[model samples]
Target: MNSKIQNDIKELVEEQVISKEIAASIENYYKSKKGDTPNRLFTVFAVLGSTLVGLGIILILAHNWDSFSRSIKTVFAFTPLIIGQLIVGYTIIKKKNITWREASGVFLFFAVGSSIALVSQIYNIPGNFSSYMLTWVLLCAPLIYLLKSNALAILHIVFVTSYACSFGYFNGNNTPWMYLVLLAVMMPYYYQLLKNKKIHNITSIFNWLIPLSAVIVLGTFVKKSEELGFLMYVILFGLLYNIGKIPFFDNQKLRRNGYLILGSLGTIYMLLLTSFEWLWKDILRHEIIINSQEFYVSVVLLLVTLGVLIFSYSKKRIQNFNLFQYVFVMFTIIFFLGVSGSIISIILINLLTLILGVMAIKIGADKFHFGILNYGLLIITALIVCRFFDTNMSFVLRGLLFVSVGVGFFLTNYMMLKKQKGKIE
Candidate 1:
């Protein structure tokens, strides 16, 4: 039962808007529906408690390592894993509710990692951290489904992101292709979370984590023609934005719609940063290998983004996409326009920035939302700040430009608030 609804019911009855009997009946109905749902706070603490226990156990065993015999060390190494398994087994067999399942699953997840490390250390296993991370991730992947644990799912995303960094960035490896496969395997669970529509907080966390993990690991896919990865990132953000606009997520609040937030911000960041002449100059000067892995990856991402947009159009998820959604498509055209066209592309980028900023302001004003309105101002401010370094305009001129924008911010927000306040009155 939602506490907000319950409070409203209680107040209604007290105010004679609803009879006491009707309030009791409403409360009973809701309690019957949601009584089994675990308290979200308890769920968080349970997972945290299990994590601390797992860490404390590891610390205790490490403290006595020198004194233990080989057999004792082996036993100690497996102890936590065994205990975690028992707890999980009990939960499954007894059909324990979400709290126990989450706690046990989290404990087992850490236990698996700890056990792997301890055995490797004791037996002198020769493997890099990347390999260990991969092994741990593969081993713990099953626990996510077995325990039906969102906490474990979140942990899986974190580890896979770490694995991508370890392998792709530090290991002299090119692309961690397995990262995609690992990421793909988790999608079904995410889909189920959305389909169920219960435990919204967990669903929201996954929403945020999934895109954020992709954003973090995206750089790992970049190789030669590495500048092309910027194009790939914008398309990826476009895809995320499109997905966020799908019916299920489109109805949610901006705070809950992680894909849209990340996509919008990411598109802005990439577009602004690439608005510089230096990047365009570098692109023109460099020899981009058409056959490079990065090039192919960019192509794949573009195709997929286009495909998603088409699907969205067919489904009527959006009658029209925001200007931010088109950035990726426009960026590609500019990306290919090399040579002396760099100047033209730079001009186009600046225009796109200005147009997007203006559009945001208009949308914010129309929606009468202070957040959206301020976000538009923020974009314009960022653009001006970027121009601060890139232009030869005199200090006095730039100062005036900044001052004008500052005044626009104040006036726009002031007018919006006045409108809102008058409407309220």
Candidate 2:
């Protein structure tokens, strides 16, 4: 009797015949609810709105160009900038709800500033481009603080960096001090972005841009001599090493990608430096231009060396001594030894490459599959074989050297790969 009553209850429930209204209520109760959809439409509208406003401003400027006197045009250029400052000031004071109007106003300010600078140049105004750029950046800097405007702040930073790279780099006026100043200027805004945790995308953009700019500007001053260039690489890699030591759990993507990009590029650059004979040849053949005092170079080198030592000691991690850092320090010490002019440095360099290449392959094989270190080893092996088998050598000897190096490379790499597979299995 109990089984029969239970079966009947199951049949009734499965039929869903507890009246149409109750059945509908039960279905609704179990149905999953969805939250609001993403606002892609707003994003599209914002992009379109900015484009139209930019075009409208350009059109107005074009139409007025012929009729307006030079002074009037100049006044017109600054008028937008002045208005932008007022709008930003008002936004700061009121702390009102953000609206499209305020955003558009800030965007216009950027457009107006750029237009003024560009138009002034087009008319061949007798003003310096650097000075104008400096002024514009200074004016925009306060907007970042006063209105808490990330967009304006980033725009200013990018413009300043671009200007510095163009003028300072090409003109041979770039200095470490200049890079330090630019970094300083951007630091406060960087701090604010971190504190608020807003505008993360913008913050990421500046983080990459600022460091890259520093590298480019600093590189110009660094390439004065082979020794100095080697010193610069040491500093560059030291910076990379410090960056890699950051706690990865906080931002794995940023930390890993940053190290990879900077380290890879720095390594390739140092490799090219190692391979080229021009740097050493130039130093040996000609008197080095000593426009600056030796103290300058010594000071820069000391600071970079101290930075590396401090970080290495503080971290106490073996991995901190990466390929770039090791090569940089080795090159610096070798160059300072006054033996770079000898033919022996070439042999020594090649030998170093072979050893490091083998070590890299061995270490990488332990961590990753596919013998990832084979590429570096292959490059070094090729260089050694080519150097030993040049036309200056007898044919039989050249053939033997090539075969020996080639066989060694194949055997070592194959063993590494085989060991990796065994571990994985």
Query: Cα-based RMSD of the predictions, in order?
Result: 2.2, 9.1
Candidate 1 residue lDDT tens string, 196-266:
96347779888899999999999998866777787788888988887787777878887889998899899
Q: Which stretches of candidate 1 lie over 4 Å from their true place?
A: 1-23, 339-341
User: Candidate 2, TM-score vs. the true structure?
Assistant: 0.68
lDDT of 1 at 180: 91
Estimate candidate 2's alpha-carbon lDDT, on a 0 to 1 scale: 0.57
lDDT of 2 by residue, 1-425 (tens): 24564455456668974655664554444442212322445544653566476567667887767788877777766665666556555655677433433364455556666666756755886766565766667655665555555556656667777667655665555443443565587788777665665334555665566556656655555545435555565456546544544443114443323443564456544654555455556553334445653326645755765575566667764344445445656655555543335665555565656666666665566655343466566656656554664337887877887787678778777887687679789
Candidate 2: regions farther than 4 A off: 1-52, 70-75, 86-109, 115-125, 147-150, 172-177, 191-204, 222-227, 248-251, 254-256, 283-298, 315-323, 338-340, 369-425
In order, candidate lDDTs are 0.87, 0.57
Q: Pick the candidate with the highest lDDT.
A: 1
**How close to the true structure is residue 402 of candidate 1, measured as C-alpha lDDT?**
90
